[model samples]
Target: MSRIVILAEGSFQFHAAKTAVGVIRYSKDTVVAVIDSTKAGQDVAQALQTNFGIGIPIVRDIREALPYQPDTLLIGIAPRGGNLPAAWRWQLLTAIEAGMNIVSGLHFFLSDDEELRQAAEKHGVMLYDVRRPPEKKVVANYTPHRAGSHTILAVGSDCSTGKMTTMLELEQTARQRGLNSAFVATGQTGIMISGNGLPIDHIICDFLAGMVEEMVLDFCEKYDWVFVEGQGALNHPGYSPVTLGLLHGTLPDAMIFCHIAGATTIDGYQHCPLPSLPEMIRMNEDAVNWLHPHHNSKVVGISLLTHHLSEAEAHAEIQRIEQETGLPTVDVLRFGADPLVDAIQRYFNA
Candidate 1:
């Protein structure tokens, strides 16, 4: 396992810092430090406002983190367009000069950058582009999910709305109930936690659905239910393609609609207001139906991320959503996933 020093820099704990937070929570790689100049001299827990139960220092730059002896420098921020910022280049160059390998999930491939490429070659360090799709030619083949595999896909109102977290929580709840279930991780965070999964967004659009279909089919014989971790939102202008592919590919029986309470718009796109919860539900249903008209998928539950709200406010919001949608609803993390799990069990009459 590589010892990774995350370069989150200006974006720690914010939406852009999602990849950083994921590594902090799930990476098997030793996370010696996080390079966030804004949060320098602070513990990661303190900066994030949640105790990770581990000590991870936040430093100002790569030089400050060198003492921790990280072999890999992982870029943990996914800015819009997946472009590497001009300001971050110097620090990244410094890390490469120090013989640290680079790992990035951005669409802007580090290997494509001449300076980064030459420096890495000079230092004999590898650059792992996590989001680059496989080069081999492939075709998208549609197949309905086989019966008896009660699959649930965690579709969200917007990107970074806790789809992965909800899926993991549901899977954990299933295990505690002694039911046979498996989690199908489709992103970096989920893959790190589960130790295996395809990064669906990285794949070319033509093969995205086929890849999901293959993954779901592979898991069917082994588990009674498979919870697929959904990607971007159908309403998200930037990431809707991957979202639609996962919906059509998995063709799940049920969906747990995820939304961040009080979020009027997407995290970065303030100008683009979010559609109503009912509309988001309809969008997902329409996508699934368009792919598999026979598969009558419905939103079975609502998973709200209420971390920004007070406990009472969250509870009230939960009640409001339940009353409005006539669906079981809960904040998966604030309260245990029991309500959501019970909702799904009730749906399947388990």
Candidate 2:
């Protein structure tokens, strides 16, 4: 049977540990052990029993856990400002040396760490950052035909909070406006759709740069509107950095930022502390400043993905953000299609 080990730092004890356990269980592979020095000697089985109800021992050190000879190692160590911790790096290197495949969610794994990536490549060990899937094969000859009055609306958040659903809703909303819109999966979880009767390639792999340019050009030429979704979490490789980078030179006429106001989003903002609200606000402002100035693009509006907030609470949050940023905000669920179209029209007209 295949076996896997999990290593996590103190910072990732709660969420990362839980995620690691789920991956192991879903893989149908035996979980050899969990290594958390702070929680050493504690029964991994009992510690995780509350969450997973499965018994697995928690060991103090990698050496102690190695006797089981795991086939894979999942690292759940917290990133140090987007970089891997030295201890975690050492652990990964050791695991690779031991001939175990490594998978991690650390952002540094997607960085310019040639040594780390090359070492794993040399060992023929697969490393999945979990933020972005490995690149896939692209179709070389596929080219999208230009359509008249077609506008591709691409909306992305700084993170991964309800991006998929929001994009889908935007598609439906566009259809109500008598405009043809389809969802394109630029990231790992996005759906594939045909454009102008041609099968569009996956955004992340095939035509990331080309698609952005082509879509923008197509929007200028053919379709009424196109809606592209953005994710919430910035640390993930499949998030907006790449998409935004591709849009640097060729930006759409307008863009919308989606903000989620739910329990998950609140917890993500508060406890998880991936990207704080203030930081995100500042980031969006910066992005707007750059695009608005350089590319002559405008921030059309902001959409609230209210999964849990009451109408009053949601409006209050939107009001606060609008007052601070001086930008119009629309509660996607409450405003329906008219407000969205108005926002799009106002910005495009400006």
Off by over 4 Å in 2: 1-157, 180-183, 192-207, 215-221, 231-240, 262-295
The residue ranges of model 1 lying beyond 4 angstroms of the native Cα positions read 188-195, 266-272
RMSD (Cα, Å) for all candidates, in order, is: 2.5, 10.4
- For residues 216-326, write the lDDT of model 2, one tens digit per residue: 455444455655545333333444455454444234445565666543333344544345444554554465446446434555566776536677887788788777656
The model with the greatest TM-score is: 1
How high is each candidate's TM-score? 0.89, 0.46
lDDT of 1 by residue, 42-153 (tens): 9888898886815899999999999999998988888878899999999889999999998887879999999999999999999877766556544556655567788899
Top of the candidates by lDDT: 1
lDDT, candidate 2, equals: 0.54
lDDT of each: 0.85, 0.54
